[model samples]
Target: MAHQGFPRGLRILTAGEYRHVFDNASFKVHGKGLLALACPNTLGHARVGLVFSKKNVRRAVDRNRLKRLTRESIRLGQHRLPAVDIVVLSKRGAGELDNDTVQRQLHGMWRRLEQEAKRHLAATQSIA
Candidate 1:
């Protein structure tokens, strides 16, 4: 079986790395209570960053739950995702969502991001 761990390499560890995606995001995927901004990368795999603000989540426990869910969702779906740096931002209502609802929304967003990435790849390839 293929290893499906959320390794350090798959995480946006540094502030500089997160800033790179924030500044150069070319694709935006929005869901009910989440927003994912992504930019193409040359790393040949996808990476993710989470920004669950204290004001938005209101509790450390809630924030941690959201982050865990987000990481798990990304880990399972990473194979289908393109090589991009994705930063996921939680909105005010995100903490209220149930696990199932959050997972569904995340899956939908991933699909949208995949489509956008494919279109972008094709467009860029055609121009080159």
Candidate 2:
């Protein structure tokens, strides 16, 4: 069976890596309580970064929960995504949502991101 884990390879692990995506985001997918910035990459697979600040989430428990949900959402949907670096940021109201609500919003965001990435890839290919 294929390994089903959030391995290091799928994570954006450094300040510089996160900065690169923040500085050069090609597109954004916005959902209730969350916003995702994405830029195409050459890595042949998707990588994810997350930003859940204390200012937004207010509690460590809530922050952790958001991270878990985001990671799982990415893990399950990564194969359908194009090669891009994505950073998911939390908004002030995210911490108040129930798990089911958060998951539903996350799933929708992933679907939107995937569609956006496909269009970006197609456009770049045509331009090349």
Candidate 3:
């Protein structure tokens, strides 16, 4: 089946909530962006929070813009992903890219994320 974008039910907020998903992270590379993931199980569905830290990119506006881009991209391509508490952090120049460019990069990241989720689901099923 084809992947659909992230749904409203999969959004994470608050400092405490952020820590919940950021506790443990996995590092992956896809296209021009870096995909960071944290798989903390939630009550019903997954909540995702994308972080573009100021320390990594510098400037508040840039950080916010990149975060917005990452969130939208995830929302636009969350179908293939399983229930995951994910966080996608931007590297250098992520803020410099245009919306179209960011979209393309995010699409590629989603592909990797889909594969990762499949692996995770398989492992989980084995455990159960």
Candidate 4:
């Protein structure tokens, strides 16, 4: 079995890092109650940042739950993902979704990011 750990380097720990993804995103996608923003990276591996706002999810417990779900989903699928910096933001309805639904949505979103990042990278390489 592969080590599926969310290491510090694989996390967007700084505000600047998160801002970079948000400001220079290559692709953005929306699902049930989640929004995913992605930007291709030169790191050769994927990194992730998550946002669960108090305005979107009123309860602290709900926010933590969403973050845990997001991190777990990313950890499981990180190996198959392209080299990209991804930021996932929760919306108002995200708290209402069940664990299974959140996981399913997150999985689908990661898959979409994979496809989009591939295309974006190819296009950039062709131009350079």
Candidate 5:
């Protein structure tokens, strides 16, 4: 089957949606590394957001590159996530890092997200 990325049915596209993710969810993935958090979207498919702060990286080119890497990581990992919207923010260190570094960090976070979603799915299945 072809890979479906960020399907229309699963996008959370509003400021309110982003704020809700930040406000209600607790971070799930933290390590000698990156952190991951997921807030199930009332909206349909999963979305992603990357925040690269200029204060940390200083170069617009670097910031955008980091964002691109983050997106690719999510695209590769999309199937593992729940049918919810998502936003992946880039920390200050993001811009300073290379694309490979950002990609590794993001995929690591996505792995945790996948595991958590699996657990949630199992709980739902058992309850139903």
Candidate 6:
């Protein structure tokens, strides 16, 4: 089995980094329990930021679990994603979802982000 680690470089660690993506996101994908916003970056790999607020998921353990699942999904699908900075925000009631269901939703969100990224790039290129 291959080991795939989620390195610090592939994360949005600072508030500024999160704000930058939020302010300049070029594409967005909406899901039942998740929302993904993506912006192209000069870095040659995709990076991710997670926003799981207490207001949405009151329990610390539940929030942590969601973050873990999100990071795992992103790490697994990173190769398929473009070089963009992505922010995944959890909506209210996300903590109520089962692990398998959350995993499935994350997978779908990743695929949608990829498609949206491609479409955004194509549209920009055509306009230019």
Best by TM-score: 1
Off by over 4 Å in 3: 1-9, 26-33
Error of 6 at 104 (Å): 1.0
lDDT of 5 by residue, 1-128 (tens): 98846554444567887787778664356522244556766444566654456676678898777666666666665546665556665555655666666667777767777778778778879999
If candidate 5 were superposed on the true structure by all CA atoms, what would the RMSD be?
Answer: 3.7
Is 1 or 2 the stronger prediction by TM-score?
Answer: 1
lDDT for residue 48 in candidate 3, whole number 0-100? 73
lDDT of each: 0.93, 0.90, 0.68, 0.87, 0.63, 0.89
lDDT of 6: 0.89
Q: Please list all clashing residue pairs in model 6, or write none if there are none.
A: none
Q: List pairs with backbone clashes in candidate 2.
A: none
TM-scores of the candidates are 0.94, 0.92, 0.70, 0.90, 0.73, 0.92
Residue ranges of candidate 5 with Cα displaced over 4 Å: 1-12, 31-34, 42-44, 76-79, 124-128
**Model 2 agreement with the true structure over 1-128: per-residue lDDT tens digits:** 98778999999999999999999999899888999999988999889999999999999999999999899888775448778999999999899999899888888887888888888778979999
Ranking by lDDT: 1, 2, 6, 4, 3, 5
Which scores higher on lDDT, 1 or 3? 1
Candidate topping lDDT: 1
User: In the order shown, what is each candidate's alpha-carbon RMSD?
Assistant: 1.8, 1.9, 4.7, 2.0, 3.7, 1.6
Better of 2 and 3 by TM-score: 2
Candidate 5 or 1, higher TM-score: 1
lDDT of 3 by residue, 68-113 (tens): 7777766656555556777777777666677788778777766776
* Tens digits of per-residue lDDT for model 6, 13-126: 999999999999987888778889889999988999999999999999999999999998887654498899999999999999999999888888888888888887899899
Candidate 1 wrongly placed segments (more than 4 Å): 1-4
Per-residue accuracy of model 1 over 26-71 as CA lDDT, tens digit each: 9999999899999999999899999999888898988999999999
Question: What lDDT score goes with residue 23 in model 4?
Answer: 92
